[model samples]
Target: MKVLKPIYFLLALFLSFYPLCSRGEMSAGDYYIYADSVNTGGVISGGDYGVRGTFNESPIGFTTSTSYETRGGYQPMELGMKVSASSLSLGTLSATAIKTASADAIVWSDAGTGYTLSIGGVSGTSIANVSDGIITIGSEEYGLSVSGVDRAFTNDRAIAERLILASSSEPVTNSKTTLTFKASISDTSVGGSYSQAIVLTVSGNF
Candidate 1:
């Protein structure tokens, strides 16, 4: 029997907004008050210090058993975020699988034959199609659909599309979300080492 080693990479990107306010000095006047002196502070001054967001983990790992072809298992990836902005938007998540030795390799091309990625265990915001692996939150697939690929990992071929992992109209602080990846081998799958990279990004709207 051949041994199969599959690696998964997780990367998170965060975008925050910080605004500064100017202070004005008022003097005693008749009807309307006029400011004799005004002081403008530079950006990154006099604002919320803890208004940024972060992820709990980096380069999240996943390992499959030797008998993954017969029996599949779940790889759980937990991610956390905190934002002080009035609104938040989660960007699309993408994945690209490549053979360790070969740049062009195809695993499971047939539909519903390779692997399925899903999202669950969310806090602070609501998500749709939690386990379906289809488009739900933004406008595209919520998770990756592992199908057989004949080319290298490129932007058009590697993207999962509109993941929309999480969002909020109000401020969300220290919230957690989990991604569950289930892998399996098809009849055409070869025995070797395989790996893939997953990227996720978060942005805020003030």
Candidate 2:
């Protein structure tokens, strides 16, 4: 098979999120009864703190507001994610053709609101990235695209500081996102077996 002009890359996946609302206590049988948001609604100074509460709602006589029960028992927000691979090898760079590579990330979250996934260059890069959101074969260009819901990188985009790849507004399970990296080079482009390092971070919105 004709290999796509591929670049070598090392990647790292980090899983962490800010619990914006409640603090999680030790897990009890079912409910998170501790550290889960201080249930006090008052203006300590000029800051107005909103009250957070969990309840069992009924659709019979109400609109059945569900956000209040985001964590299902109002438990602390939770999230998990995994990358399918840690490295990508795009055989050899070509001057007359484009090369592509891809990797998959599966994420699950119970943060009530949802989660965010982003990619950023860990350090300097030798191959310049395409900033115009397009790849041309006659120039040395590198960029990335993504396939999934709430994707910010749906089109070719340069790898910048914490570039968001995808996000969700509601809780999701087994949300799989595929990231495709594309590259091109001209006859005058530099030739070498170089590798770049990047990071994928997933954050939950609790």
Model 1 per-residue lDDT at 68: 52
State the lDDT of candidate 2 residue by residue for 94-155, as single tens digits. 88888989999899998878888987456656488897878888889888889977676557
Candidate 2: lDDT of 158?
A: 81
Candidate 1 lDDT score at position 105: 14
> Which window of ten consecutive residues has the lowest lDDT sum in model 2?
7-16
Error of 2 at 200 (Å): 0.6
Span of 10 residues, lowest total lDDT, candidate 1: 98-107
lDDT by residue for model 1 (1-206), tens: 12322221111111112211223322233221222112321122123331122223332354356765322222222333332232222322322321111111111212222222222223331222224433332332222222222111112111344334334333333333333332333334344433334444443422
Task: Flag regions of model 1 displaced more than 4 Å.
Answer: 1-162
TM per prediction: 0.26, 0.63
